[model samples]
Target: MALNKKPVKGMKDILPEEMQIRDYAISVIKETYGKFGFTSIETPCAESIANLTSKQGGDNEKLLFKVLKRGEKLDVAGAASEEDVVDFGLRYDLTVPLVRYYSAHSAQLPSPFKALQIGNVWRADNPQRGRYRQFMQCDIDILGEASNLAEIELILATTTTLGKLGFKGFEIRINDRRLLKAMAAYSGFPEEAYDSVFITLDKMDKIGPEGVKTELLENGFGESCVERYLELYQGLEKAEDGVAYLADMLKGVAETSVTDNLREIIDSVQATKTAGFEMVFDATLVRGMSYYTGTIFEIAIPEFGGSCGGGGRYDAMVGKFTGKEVPACGFSIGFERIIMLLLENGFQIPDRPKKIACLVEKGVEGQALCDVIAKAQAMRETGSQVLVVRMNKNKKFQKEQLMAEGYAEFEEFYKEGLRN
Candidate 1:
């Protein structure tokens, strides 16, 4: 009989070779996040339907992997759920559940709490290049205080960490959703135009100016207003030169509410960051989340096919449930995507050996082999992979067999590992 074993279409098992790179990326993220006063926390993989669906923007809820209630008991809770659910659905992303966790436990947390979360997130969306149904997301968020300073710090922290991890040619694109709203007002678009405008803006980089224009027109955007927005990306502006661009866009806008909020954003970016990431006042960046009441960003490396990761402010998410608004902003990096970039581009990360194959002659010396096994067991206790090599015995024949198997590292006969 043939063996039947393979991962499902959108999932993959991490092989030993790939695991070295994966662990290194995770360690780099954890250590980097720790220095910024962000404490690590984890929530359940399954979250209640209410928490998952409640106020999550975009098509995120559509991707949720719902867990069926046991033994037809779902009928008992039908139409009107007495309790939210015990057999909850798999979490779509860490943000929603993290917000739920914070809102429920806010009294126990310090004012202006910062958290670092790293975990697997599932999306039922069709897998494509660099996108998997199950993937890892690493995020750091600050909650309970509205501070533009937090945005600056988060950008610096992420760039610094990625730099330390040996990435190059990457830039952090920063934009204030407040400023997008200001532009929408300046252009005389309405409140209902909010979601569509941002989503269209996000596709600007991907679809080119003309394509975006066509899309907007197809989506019912007036031609004259779209022309005014397309001017932001045409010029060659570096990170340092973006302030002038922002001032030009916001100039003479009577909406002081948006302008004043934007001044805070400008000051936050201008106050001198030691990290080498460019911040552009991109009026074009509308992070797809509806509740994003402030700054938004996406990090991209030029060599990669897509933005490495992105996230932004979502202040109204928690307020819908708890009735008290919580100020919050965060970003998530595509963990597996980063690994692919490193592996493909020769980015080196710390590596550890995952397997050790030990070999022994069949009938030569059981007692002598016992000593070798003892040493191997000691290494195994410390989490080293060790496999005792068993073979048909005749000392001379077995010796040749071991060498042919590339087990010459065993010439030390038990002193060193297989690779040695």
Candidate 2:
């Protein structure tokens, strides 16, 4: 009989404190990305179910929040399948919608467009720490650029933005889908089994190398293939240059261009990065996107002990929309997770405007109130945050609440005069 006060399962209501941090993070992201020539764009939250389930989003397609047909279109009772009932779904990530956006607007857009998008995405996922069914994603993508320049600029821009936000000593773990496939092929795995193999491989951090080996073998892969595949990882741990080693090891099995491109991206980012971070060649990094045709990467924060954000080359995605190929690469910041870490570590916004609270007693007359308001307005014009409110019966408690909201200086105006 009572209305539910709680949010739906897996979603959250952001409070003022968290909202402050979220706002600041978004500003820094937008400002930093804007300097890199990424023009901001927007796309609708809901997308056609057909496009969302086009098999490009990998496992994320399974987590889509499907939207049912409308009144006239609704035939749920007579529907034979989900397709007959659902027509659209809330987008699970920005990339899919972005590709669709580009497809429709390419004629009006510039060549090699650098686009920046920040928005909420929904997934019917099991909520956990640092994860929610609805969360914000900050993505910057370069379309129509085939060379590794796109990768270099993305890594640089993302890392620089992180640095500006006071993130230090994070790792940008880079890999290539081609390299993943090459390693598997060199180990005698069939092309068809690459996806399943990489699915297990993506858990290397949790399951460890031995765990990955066991899972691979248990999945009916050849024991020799498993050993040979994992040996590459072991070799990487010892090799001075993992990319070079892979380039030579998988030379005949895979294209030399894959390794060369990956190597170029790593070398270029390392040479030009402005952030206090490392550009690592992580052989185990298998970003969970079926559309990623080339280099894949993730942001690894030491404090979080997991990926904070990541993106990769999805050269084939736009082709799906237009039937013509276009080279595209993107990087997305793990916005919610980063905010969680910042909140957990008590990250305060630097250089915040001075906060002053103007508390007027209840009996303060019309002229007195106008004078107090005028004074607060003057303070606001001078770049201060002024909160003018009627003084409560318990002034101390009111001030305490204001203090918690970052209001430090207080001015109490009584009908008679200013109170100390």
Measured on C-alpha atoms, candidate 2 has an lDDT of 0.92
- Clash totals in order: 3, 0
Candidate 2 Cα misplacement greater than 4 A, ranges: 417-420
Taking the tens digit of each residue's C-alpha lDDT, what string does model 1 give over 1-420? 987597887888986547877888888888988998888999989887667766674687778787767665666645365343335678888888888889889999997898999998888989887888898888998897686667766776777778778876667777777677666666656768867876777787788788877887888878877766555455425435554555566677634555455566656654665555665556576766666777788887787866788888888877876998988989888777788888887654445444455666455356677787897898789876676776444656866765543344442353234232
Residue 213 of model 2: what lDDT?
A: 88
Backbone clash pairs in model 2 (N, Cα, C under 3 Å; residues 3+ apart or in different chains), count? 0
lDDT of 2 by residue, 224-278 (tens): 8999888888888989998899888887887888888888888888888888999
TM-score of 1: 0.81
Q: What lDDT score belongs to each candidate, Candidate 1 first?
A: 0.73, 0.92
Q: Candidate 1 has which clashing residue pairs, if any?
A: 358-387, 358-389, 359-389
Predicted structure with the largest TM-score when compared to the true one: 2
Q: C-alpha displacement of 170 in model 1, angstroms? A: 0.7
Instruction: List pairs with backbone clashes in candidate 2.
Output: none
